[model samples]
Target: MANVAILELSRNCAKTVEEIVKLERKIFPKHESLASFFHDELKKKNSGLLYLHVDGELAGYVMYSWPSSLYASITKLAVKEQYRGQGHGETLLKAAVEKCRTRKVSRIMLHVDPLRTPAVNLYKKYGFLVDTLIQGYYSSDRDAYRMYRDFDSS
Candidate 1:
């Protein structure tokens, strides 16, 4: 049986950030990756990162930022190829959402490649609805779906 753990990263954890950057490079293209700005992102007051570990090995991570009191954005979610299809993405996402909820944000948002069916389905399962199609959001030839989930604040 695999032992699973989800941890909220602290801003000053350099070793963990290094590991996350390595995983980010493996999971995303250079143009879309957060590797170069990850450390700086963590330094922001409203940003947070949640990482997953399976049997002590890094499996995935989610980065989020609540820039304002009313909304939060999931900036990135990535799972190592070896860990794909094993529910690590969902775990990371759930944690990110819950974190935002605890902050009393009214909505959560993210952008995803429309062609990534599995990711789109996962977001849908979590109640995120597409807000619009972003032209060249990822690149000149790639488009993205801006998705969001609103919480009942009343």
Candidate 2:
């Protein structure tokens, strides 16, 4: 059986941040990746990261920020290719949302590539609804869907 764990990352965690950055580069396009700014992001008071390990191996992670008490945003969520379809993404997402809930945020939002059906489905399953379509949100050739989940409604 696999041992699963979710850990909240702190800014001082240099070694773990490095590992996450490596995984970030592998999962996202260069321009869209947070690798270059991850540490800086963690330095913000309202932002944080949660990473999951399966049997002591990095499986996935989610980065989130609540700039105000009313709203929170999921900045990134990624799972290693080998770990896809194993529910790690959902697990990370649930953690992120719960973190926001603890902050008493009224809503949580995220932007995802519309082309990624599995990701879209996962968010929908978690009660996130499409709020808008942002043209070229990822790149000139790509677009994204801005999705949100309202805590009050659920």
Candidate 3:
């Protein structure tokens, strides 16, 4: 989308889930989409926020939550196929970092699919260091690497 706006997703998040499912399905043939996880997280009323955008006809979405928790989690970050290379991902990440800083979180955490080299590189570029590796993490025959960015709240 030419105009990028960040909205706190409550209802529009349903659409976001759909997009995520579609993307995830491309990689996982039999895996279900994570739309429910997004909905449930919001329903839990925890400290999570999703930033979404309208790109003419497509949707660009990034979700982040738990900024105030001991280990705030970055649940998901996705941009539509046509929206990639548009800097949307970086902008979303910057916003997520700022949100974490505002919450005074000690650390930010996210799990990356080991096979996804691009994602791994992106996290590294963003200064997220590997915390550990979780074997057999994804049911889709994928391993997960846990990464974290330590932000001093002091």
The lDDT values for all models are 0.94, 0.94, 0.69
Give lDDT tens digits, candidate 3, residues 117-153. 8778888999999999898777746779999999865
**TM-score quality measure for candidate 2:** 0.97
Model 3: lowest-lDDT 10 consecutive positions: 27-36
Off by over 4 Å in 3: 11-32, 54-58
Give Cα distance to truth, residue 102, candidate 2, Å. 0.7
Looking at model 2, the pairs that clash are none
Task: Write one digit per residue (lDDT tens) for candidate 2, span 32-145.
Answer: 998998878989999989999999998889999998988999999999999999999999999999999999889999999999999999999999999999999999989999
Angstrom error at residue 22, model 3: 5.9
- Judged by whole-model lDDT over C-alpha atoms, candidate 3 comes out at 0.69
lDDT tens per residue, model 1, 1-154: 8999999998778898999999888878999988998878999999999999999988889999999999999999999888899899999999999999998999999999999999999999999999999999999999999999999978
Best by TM-score: 1
Where in model 1 is the C-alpha error above 4 Å? none
**Model 3 TM-score, 2 decimals:** 0.79
Each model's backbone clash number: 0, 0, 1
lDDT score for candidate 1 against the true structure: 0.94
- Look at candidate 2 and tell me the lDDT of residue 20: 97
